[model samples]
Target: MAQAGTAKQPNILFITVDQMRFDCLSIAGHPIVETPNLDELARTGVRFDRAYTATPSCIPARAAIFTGQSPAHHGRTGYEDCVPWRYEETMPGELAKAGYHTQCVGKMHVYPARSLLGFHNVVMHDGYLHHNRMRHNVAAKDHFDQVDDYLVWLRQQVPSADLVDLGLDCNASTVARPWELPERLHPTNWVVSESIDFLRRRDPSKPFFLWMSFVRPHPPFDPPQAFLDLYKDAEIPEPPVGDWAMQEDPMQLGLNPVTDKGLVPKRRLKQAMAAYYALITHLDHQIGRFLQVLNEYGEMNNTIIIFTSDHGEMLGDHHMFRKAVPYEGSARIPFILNDPGNRLGLKRGAVRNEVIELRDIMPTVLDAAGARIPDAVDGRSILELARAGSASPDRQQDASLDSAVQGWRPHLHGEHAYGHLSNHWLTNGKEKYIWFSQTGQEQYFNLEKDPLELHNAVNDAEYADCIVHWRQQLIEELKAREEGYSDGEQLIAGIAPRSTLSFLKA
Candidate 1:
C-alpha cells in the first residue's frame, strides 16, 4: 500500500448522482431497474445498505458531502438556492493541500455558478437551474451560456440544440420523455465524455481527486429512447402508499404537477417510473464507459472509487414527489466504496448496515487519500469499520454485536424543512422514529420487518419504549438549536424553519 503524502498515493474517483433512490439498483433487489455496472462495483467493494442524507435535498445534502459537516453545522437545512458556499474546509480543498490535483466534471451546485471550491479546474453543468435561467439577459453571470460548459459544447455540436427544447420542466413536472436529440449528445453522455477527456489531460505527477457528478434521474425524467425501451416490458412496482399517507382528496393535489404530495393517475405514475429507471440504467452504462477508460489507462487497480448520491427521489412514495421529506425514499441513499488495491483492506462484497450519511464522505475519501481530515469536519472516518470486515450474521438479531465495531454512532438524526412535510427523524438502520416539526405528528417504523415503511407503528404499545428513546434523542439533538424546536423537555411544533441558519447568513 502507498503511504499517505507519498508520490504513490492512489487516485480517488468520487461519483454522485442526483435524486436516485436507495432501492433502485437491481443489485439491491429492485424489481425493475437493472444496474449491472453498479452491481459489479458493489461486488468488488463495500456497500453500506443504510446510507442516508440528513437534509435530503440538492444544496444542503451537497453541503454535507463537501464540507464534512452536519446540516446544523453547515446551516443549510432545506432546499434553497443562491446561498453562497463559504466553507473554508472542503473535500477538494483539503485533498489539493495534500498535493493531489482535483478536478470536477459535472454539477457543483455551488453559488457564483463557477466557484471551483478548491478544484484546480471545473467543467460545469448543474442541469437547468432556474436561478440561472431566470436571468433575462443572455450574458448574465448565472446564465446557461456563462456557466454550463455542456450547453456550450452542445451548441457547438448542434447549432440549434437547446436543453429545454423538449418542453419539460426540470423539477416541477413528473412528465416522461426520451431524449429528443441524438443519444450521444445527451447530458449524461456529455458528463462521461468530459470526464474521459479530463483523465487524458490530468497531471501525471500528482495523485488526482476527480468528482464526476451527474445531474440526472432528478427531473425532466428523460432518458435515451433505447434505455426507455429496456424497461418497457418490465414489471415496475407501484409506489407503496403508507397507511398514514392516504389523501382526503387525492385529485385536488394530484392535478398540480409541482405538488409535493398527491395521487396522480396510475398511467402517468408508471410512465414516470419507467423514465426514472431508464435514466438510472443509462447512467449506469455511462459509468461503465468511464470504468473501461480507467482500465485502459491502467489506473483501475491503483484507484479508490466511491459511489453515492446527494439524496433520494420520493417518486410518489407515501404520495410524496421530489425530496425534503424525512421518509425512507427521500432520505436513504446508496453508498458503495471500492478500494481495488486493498490499501484499506476493506472486505469485498461486504454489505454493511451501519447508519452512514453524506458528512462521512469527506472523511472517508480523505482517509483513503492519506490526507488530513479537517478539524472542522463533524464526521468520523469509516475506514476502521471497513477494515473490520462485515458484521456477523447474528449481529442483526442481537444488540450485543454492536460492540464488535467501535466508534460507530448508535443512530443517525435526519431532518428537512418542507412546510407540512418538514420532519426530524432518528434511526439505527433497524427502526426509525419521526416527529413532524410543523404538526407534532409522530411515526415509528420497524425497518427490519417493513423496509417499505408501509405501516406506521408509533402508537403500538409493543414499541412504546423505543418511541420514547428516539424522541428523547431528537430532543437532545435540537436543544442547542436557535429555532427552539425543543425546550430541553420535549419538541415544540409550529417553529418556522429557515433554509439557511443565521450563523451562515452572517
Candidate 2:
C-alpha cells in the first residue's frame, strides 16, 4: 500500500477482457486451457481467487469499475441499450486529477457510445454492438462505418472485410471458426498494437494510466486459425450443470435465438467451450506481446498492471448460455494485481482468497497513484490489505482484527434485472444464495463442497438456517431499491419488471 505521501506513484496499466470466466485460464487450473502467458503474469502478480462482479453484465459491471459505486448508487441494475450515463465521479477523472495522464483504447460500452468518461482521449472500439450503429436507422451501417476505430482500420487493411466474414454472430451465435482476417488484423491484436502505439507517442513527462481493453472472448468466438486449430481436436470439458438446473427459465432463454436459447445438444456445448477457450489463449498471447512491448519500452519494471473482465460468460452453465445470471460461471471473474516487483513491496505470486469486487479497482489505483479518494466511493483499497501482512497493527485501519480476519468482507450483494426477472446473489465464496425474482425461487449452493455448483442445496435440511440468514440480508438490501421487490420483511414476487434503472423515490 503506497498511501504514504513520500511513496512514489507507479504508472498503472489496466487491462480487461469481455465474457471471460474465472476458471477458464491455466493459471486458475483449468484442465483444458494452457494459458502460459497468463500463468506467467499470475506468477508476478497477486491473484484474487474470490473476486467477482457485483452486477454481472456489460454496462452495469463497467459502471461499477469506472464509478466505484454499487448498483444501488450507480443505478444500472441490468443491461440496457441507449441509457444515459451521468455519473458525477469516475476512476480516470480522479487519476488525471492526480497528475496522471489517462487514456483508453478498445471497448468502453459507455452510452451515447462515445462519451469519454473523463479520459484525456479515447481511441474507442466497442466491437460489433448492434445498437450503437444500428437498431434505429433506415440504413444501418454497423460493420462498414469508420466511426469505430477498429472497424475503420480493418476496412483499410481489407477493403471488403465485414463482421460476418468471420462466420460468427456478434450477439447470439455460439459457433466457432478461424478468423477471416489476418492474425495481425484480429481485434485482439489490433487493440494491443493501438495501445503500444499510444505508449510510444504518450507524453513522457507524467505518470500515465492506460486502459488496454480487449473485446474478444465475448462473442463471435473466432480466434485466429492457429489458436482455433490448437483446440480443434482437444477434448474440451462441458460446462457443469446443477441438478436443479434441468428446468429452464423461459424468461432468460427466450432472449436469444433458438440455437442458443438453452442447453442445446452436448456436442454443441463442447464446440462452444472449445471456441471460447481458444479465444482466451489468443487474448493471452496478445497480452504477452503487450507486456513485451512494455518491457522494451523499459516501463514494465515501474508500471502496475491489473487484469480482469467485465464479467464471466456462462458458456452453458446451468443451462445458461450468456450473462445476467447469479451463478459462479456468470459472476466470478479473473482479477489479478501486479505491482512492479522491483519498485513496489507487494507479495509476489500471492493468491489472495479474500473477497473483492469491481468497484474496488478505482480506489486501489487512486491510492497507489497517491491520489485523494473521494468520500463518496464505496470500495476499500486492497493495496492496504496487501500491506497489512507486513505493516504493524497500530497503523492498520482495521487494527482491532487480524489482517486475515480484517480482509474478510462480510458479504457482497449482486443483482440484475434481466431474464424477465431479477436474479439476485448473496455470497462470500464458501456458500452462495440466489433468489430469482419471478417465481420467488431460492437456490443455495455450498461452494466449498461444489465450486462448479453441481447440486442445488436449497432443500437440504442441513442448510435451512443458512438460507434464512441470507434471505433476510437480501430483504434488507432490496428495501432500498426503487422496485418493490421486497417488503422489508419478505420478498415480493413477480412485480412488473423494470430494466432501466429507476429513481429512488422521495
- Global Cα RMSD, each model: 2.3, 4.0
Q: How high is the lDDT of residue 400 in model 1? A: 32
Tens digit of lDDT per residue, candidate 2, span 112-205? Answer: 5677887998987888777655656534333327458887788889896777675567765456667876799988999999999988988787
Write one digit per residue (lDDT tens) for candidate 1, span 1-506.
34655777889999999999998888899989999999999998988899999999999998998899998999998888877888888999999998898999989999878888889999998998887887674534677779999999999999977888877778754568889888999999999999999889999888989999999988888899999999877787888888988756536786676667777877877888899999999999999999999999999988999999988988988878988888889899999999887877887877888888999999988888888888989888876666655775853432333553666888998888887868889999899999999899999999989888999999999999999899999999999999999999999999998888989878
**Per-prediction TM-score to the true structure, in the order listed:** 0.96, 0.92
**Local distance difference test, each candidate:** 0.87, 0.80
Q: Find the candidate with the highest TM-score and give its number.
A: 1
Q: Which candidate is the best by lDDT?
A: 1
TM-score of 1: 0.96
Candidate 2, position 356, lDDT? 89
Candidate 1 runs further than 4 Å off? 1-5, 136-141, 247-251, 392-404
Candidate 2: clashing pairs of residues: none
Clashes of each: 0, 0
